[model samples]
Target: MSSRKSILEAIKAIPREEKPLPDLPDFGISGELEEGFTQSILGNKGEVLEKSVFENWLATQDFSKILSLTESYRNLSTIELPKDPHELSTLDLAILEGQFGVAENGAIWLDDSQLFLRAIPFITEHLVIVLDRKNLVPTLHQAYQRIGDAHSGFGLFVAGPSKTADIEQSLVIGAHGAKSLRVVWK
Candidate 1:
């Protein structure tokens, strides 16, 4: 017998044991989901806002170059979605819809279907994600249960603004992506 065949036969002859999956601890913070989400987002250097607060904040800004994909804020949209992802490098602000938010880590789920250009959120100077308050989950386990395996080839859990501490342990926000992140809960 060839050496490779002999090795394969020996490997196949070995007994294997099946192990049960470990049970995840119940964080049990569902009742405080909103507070947990707010604290987590604040820890990640992101801001959480109510609809009225966000609207009031928006009113003070210059909307000349804002790009909004959500239907509710279409009136404030100034630029069209770029055909090329590279063209998004100059975006000042981008407002997109998030499918859900996780309270454990303050992450918002975004899939390819929700993003006109995959780079819009990352390329913009500021990113605003609009998510429904009812869609908040207490943990990543529950968040995954909600998403399942059905996705449009691409998905991401964005936690906050891009940051890097690579250089001399110095923190840098917006090092490679949006400088700030604001979550608008409706």
Candidate 2:
């Protein structure tokens, strides 16, 4: 058997916060999907509207070739990103638009820019999104600035799965939107 090291030695390696943390809203995912947090954002407004409003968004694109993924996004077919990212039907998830809102936490802002899906992300069932860390913000106030006054159409800010504690204060998830969320930062 290998020699065992004292448990106290391991704790010393961990880093501690240098400053006091600020109060904020809880938007992290919990429960079975507690460990999964992946998100994709498209750029611009025209692209965002086209994708959300039309089901045939990929009609002209060649979805007959790419394969699909198995993990959490099994529902999503492996659609290839266009050679020119601007080709509406080219991206697996085209981030064509975004409207910011106040976040109660030091986390980044959110809006319809990421969550307006009509179906599952993978064919197998369920979905997953690993957001880019650069998008993170310190508070919701900053999020509003990002939005400005561009209210072209519909939008929202989603935090984790749809959960409720109505039945005897018991928390339940997956009631309205996604079943899980996992926010991984760099």
Candidate 3:
């Protein structure tokens, strides 16, 4: 079979809309958001945690080694992102300051300005997203209010770690994308 067919088969196999939204209308999503929204996409538990608790949790885990493995990781502090996405390394992760959030799927719409590597999200062993307490949204429908026609540049709404359950109905996380996602709210 062709690679495209194989990929399509995999995506189709995933259980569609298996997860449901929570009952509360407030849902703890933020309201003062405009362009580039992406929060409500995550899920209920996404909002239940305190920022302090989340930050404290990060201090407990070890990401130093993972950072060292990437060929261009150390150079990011001094390097500027190339305008082209093709220039990004497969293991680079960009910590961007999100402009707004998407409520429908708990995603954050970040501008390329804060990114160090253009394709950082697609080619990284780990991803760490940091957000301020001020930016959060309720639903994907609400997120659409922020996107304008000039979405000419690149953007993405990421939720949790990358995952796939393509084999034997198994539930696996971090298959093709980063093996882990570290979210910090301050």
Candidate 4:
């Protein structure tokens, strides 16, 4: 037998060990869940608005270019989306629908099923995500359980606006992505 074949046979002779998966810890929550979620979002420097007040909030915006992928706001785009992704660099705002929100850390889940282009959220100057209150979960462990094997292609959890800190620890917000993120929920 060849050296590679001999090595493979030798490896197959070794015993294998199986280990049980560790249980996720329960991080006890205090007070109302929405309150905790709101606080987390605030700590991440993101804004939150109720679904009832979303239209009123929309009236206060001065953005000239906008795109809305949500069915509720299907006709809300001011400019037609360009065919080329590179042309979207100047997009002022992009409105999307998140599948769910995590209460513990103010993160919302987005997947390719909803995004027209994967870069729309990251390239836009501002972003608006609409999530339902009923879809909120208390922890990431539960979040993972809910998303198990469902999103096979692409998905992400966006906590807040793009932020980064350099070696000196000076924080930079919107350095490479959306300058602002607003969560409109029901």
Evaluated with TM-score, which candidate comes out highest?
1
Better of 1 and 3 by lDDT: 1
TM-score, one value per model: 0.93, 0.39, 0.54, 0.89
lDDT, each prediction: 0.89, 0.36, 0.53, 0.86
Candidate 1: which stretches are off by over 4 Å?
none
Cα deviation at 160, candidate 2, in Å, is 1.2
Q: Rank the candidate models, highest TM-score first.
A: 1, 4, 3, 2
Q: Residues 1-186, candidate 4, lDDT per residue (tens digit)? A: 999999999999999998999976897447777887888889899999887687788888888889888887768898776778788888998999999988899988899887868888899999999888888888888888899989457888998999999748989889878988899985
| Order of candidate numbers by lDDT, starting with the best | 1, 4, 3, 2
Report the alpha-carbon TM-score of model 1 versus the true structure.
Answer: 0.93
Question: Which stretches of candidate 2 lie above 4 Å from their native place?
Answer: 1-127, 184-186
Better of 2 and 4 by lDDT: 4
lDDT of 3 by residue, 1-186 (tens): 999999999999998776887655643344544222334324412332345674475457554332221232333333344567565554344444555555445576655554544457656666766665476665655555566664436667776667777899896666766665555554
Instruction: Report, for all candidates in order, the number of backbone clashes.
Output: 0, 26, 19, 0
Q: Is candidate 1 or 4 superior in lDDT?
A: 1
